[model samples]
Target chain A: MALKLYYDLMSQPSRSLYILLKYANCNFESKLLALRKGEHFGEEFTAINRLQKVPVIDHNGFVLTESVAIIKYLSRENLIPDSIYPKASKQAARVEEFLEWHHAGLRLHCAMFFRVKFLIPSIVGQPEEPKNIDGYLRRMEAALKEFDTKWLGRGNNFITGNTVTVADLFAACEVEQPKMAGYNPCEKFENINVWLKKVRDHFNPYYDEAHEVLNKIGKNKFKMASKV
Target chain B: MALKLYYDLMSQPSRSLYILLKYANCNFESKLLALRKGEHFGEEFTAINRLQKVPVIDHNGFVLTESVAIIKYLSRENLIPDSIYPKASKQAARVEEFLEWHHAGLRLHCAMFFRVKFLIPSIVGQPEEPKNIDGYLRRMEAALKEFDTKWLGRGNNFITGNTVTVADLFAACEVEQPKMAGYNPCEKFENINVWLKKVRDHFNPYYDEAHEVLNKIGKNKFKMASKV
Candidate 1:
């Protein structure tokens, strides 16, 4: 089976899928897109994906977009373990619930905070105003609180239950995003910190490898902010 | 098999599932919540769903949230048809792709437009500022343009393909939402109007039934605006 993945590590969902594929021991062609350089919008990539989003897959000739959809497709083909995405109705629903909620919940607030605090400022070559930064921070914190109380407070080893699933990976990536903006989620949400560590420990080198670019950028951002 | 669905017709996903259940001929006890009356926030409903969102399900003792997850669970149990949510990998991926994208793309923009232009104003007892309304409209229109070009323009009679799947149901509900704010999508986007008509015709009676409340509110809002 000829499979090709187009992704950017800087993107959270992209990283989540990257780690998932690695964990599954699936070998496929990696067609990385440099999102910061606007490569996703070019004619070639746009032809591959009309949506022009990263974390898309081309299996043989069939192309699929959306990370969650791609992951489910892969699971259906038996390319990924059932443990990562269960086949049982109830167990699978638990994971699916988190995946669906993640879009508008953790993902939205975390992405918004990162954009307003780090991405926009870097692109425009200026710091964001305190009020705008605070607004996004508040939203991010509220989502984090929900994640802590509702998700982790379930007293499971992961988001859905004792076993780690894609839900945990997806949530961890989103929580890690605002680190580039000098906001550490672990500092505020204790349960999230513990759960994140467990997910990272399970994924190991793959998790760290997928986040290399983000971690470097985050460290640099912190150093620069400290100097200012 | 004791099954119950907690939903509000005013909620898009709730209506989507409601129609899906009816379309599948599944017998489910309806537990409707009046969102306008803040019924979802009551202690009784809160115990059923910690998220306090509609479109939740209880099967025996198992409780599930999120419409997409609930639909998938139902499909897994053979409670729904293969035509509605294809089990074949490639075909199912097509439906999953639309479902995944719907959350952040069409749903977000359309809901934002409705909230800003109608819901908030109704609750606050005043009209929204023109600037705020314009901002959300632009975002919603951009999302609609993408939907028209990328989704409906794929040369298929429906969002995924010729068959009217749950994807069409979810998309149609979101597209219908802005009508409450006096935004008729059919007027601006010809393709959406045609595709929407097809979905409505395919699932009529049930479609019309699920949308009764929204349609009434939409007409009343239009009448109120006309008087102004």
Candidate 2:
């Protein structure tokens, strides 16, 4: 039986998981739960994840939520190569460190920027509030600066040392999210810019495919023409 | 040489790491970083962690940060029994899922509530901002409710499943931090109230010892006498 992945491409984590699953070349069922249509909040979907968050996976009888956990779990279950998630405890710990820091660091700031700049104005029919996004933008900027200086080690191919681990995929998806608002937050950081391209190129078709919906939305200038 | 642990008891993650280290019965050198004195932001600490966050560890010269990652790394390094963090991939993923969700969920809300309700007012010599705490309190309440209803299985002892994993230790620390402000948010939730005692009792002297500073600060009503 194939693994069942419940996701919505518009979600940053969902896109990361999509790319991960595709890259792993695993047999999985893709179940789209559109957030714009309130599909995720529906009773049917609630049975899968009461939290109503995306990028959940149901393998065999085991069900898991949280993109990082799902990716780590799937990595082990599918016997994915160590280069992606790593098997060595120390290497894995480095990846874990990035994953843990990401939640409050890049993930929070990027999502906040996207929500304030695009999601709110488009969905709520309200004008963009400068004060609302000011803090998020500042935090986003700080996080990006740290990502370049601290996490992105000198000449390191990925966030956690050499190979592109799950951390890179999750981060790239989040950093790309604010771009939907037509603003590239990491545009000034040379290292981040270079690393972003490396991650995108490594994932290739899967990355582009997973981001198609978001790209279309971004290209449309995040207008309220579409519900989500 | 004992593993070096850099921590601040007042910080939630720092306390979590302290309890985990003691519970594992491992030899570790405790290096207290007084946040109130601006120790974490100093030059010496910056060399250890550019982010200047607490709850970092140096084991055999391999320095690591992020409480969840540090705990996970230590769990493997010390060969602690599975009952604490677990070895099975499925079981481990559940713990990871909780830890990840915690960063944005309980940990965020709890820490924010503490900062707004106690830290900012006491330290900055400003009045407690009720408006700032409102959203955080609501989110904290919602997180606790979901934690009890969804994560805490009926009749189950811990967050994920039967055994108390690393998630419980980290969670108990965060949930308890707000108590220093003379507010026990989880006191209203029956399951959490029960689980709280269970987790607290499981760790015993170590749990109580790790919380000594915060407990004293909490007892003094978080007066501005100390800078933190």
Candidate 3:
């Protein structure tokens, strides 16, 4: 049996995982879990994940979830670069560091964008809170500034001083969400735009397939976030 | 030069890294990045970690930050067993699953507990929004229920299935925070209570000796949280 990747394109992490798997050329059965349709919350999915979420990877009988860990696990298998997690223990520590901060910073901003523009409007039936959205956008720009000034550290393919690691997967997928949700990521942070382009082309031809489906959301104010 | 840990006891992740390092008997220099004093935001500290946060590790010239990444990086050095991260991709994925969910669930509770009960009261001189606290607590408790029911599987001594993984370290530290901020963890969860005990015996002793200056709060409520 091939490795099975359970995910939904709607989820940022799941999309990251899907891209990684696709980029690595890992042959696996793709399980589409649309949480909007309540597939992830179903009993069968619950039995497998218990968390009732997507971006789950099951190898035969063994099951695993969490995109970061899964990405590292896959990377170790020569799917991506072996250096994705860092070569030295201390370097690996930096990778871990970015991973830790990424959640609260990049992850939060991207999620907030989707929540404001997409989730609230489409699912929750709530109008966007401009104040909240503005707050999140400001934070997103700040993160990109910090990313440009600090983690960019002279620019690598990923956030932690170059080389495509889980960081890129995270940064790309997350930053893309705002676009899907109708926000301009490229215009807001030009540095992030460069980073995104590098990431988009780093794997080259690799992410084209994923980006095709991902780019369906119209480019409007959303393109203003990152200055490409 | 021994490994150097730049930390602030007040930060949950820094404390977790400290405890994990101490428990492993890893020889390291301890440096305080005083957040209260605004020391972490300095140019000097920023060079150490661009994120300007604690829970950072420095081995010689190499630097790394983020508590979970730091702990896993240290634990991987063979202080703990391989069973922690698990060599299997699927098992490793499970660790990521918990860690990712941890950011939203456990970390949120811990952050809210600190922000509302302590930081707000201590710094801004205002009580936190009660509704905010209650909402997070209720959500956290519900998450705990789901974790206990399905995630724990058939084990003891850790947050995940059987052995202590990065999950436990991330969780135990976060769980302890609510107690320090005046939330009782032992309100009803039996498994969480039992598990907290193991962490206390395992990690508390280390913090006792190494973190001598800090008037660490919440041991009593740790007992409360572990009421089972």
- Model 3: CA > 4 A from native: A79-92, A124-126, A153-158, A204-206, A220-228, B79-93, B129-132, B147-150, B153-155, B207-228
Model 2 chain A: lowest-lDDT 10 consecutive positions: A219-228
Clash counts per candidate, in order, are 0, 0, 20
- Superposed on all Cα atoms, the candidates' RMSDs to the truth, in angstroms, are 1.1, 3.3, 4.4
**Candidate 1 chain A: worst-modelled 10 consecutive residues by lDDT:** A131-140
Can you give the lDDT of residue B185 in candidate 1? 91
Listing candidates in order, what is each one's chain A TM-score?
0.97, 0.92, 0.84
Candidate number with the higher DockQ (2 or 3) = 2
Clashing pairs in 1: none
DockQ of each: 0.92, 0.82, 0.57
lDDT of 1 by residue, A96-191 (tens): 999999999899999999999989898999988998688888888999999999989887889988999999999999999999889989999999
Candidate number achieving the greatest DockQ relative to the actual structure: 1
Q: What is the lDDT of residue A157 in candidate 2?
A: 90
- C-alpha RMSD between model 1 and the true structure: 1.1
Best by TM-score: 1
Cα deviation at A7, candidate 1, in Å, is: 0.7
lDDT of 3 by residue, A38-121 (tens): 988788998888667778888666677777767766665565655554556656666767777788767876787677767777
TM-score of each: 0.98, 0.94, 0.86
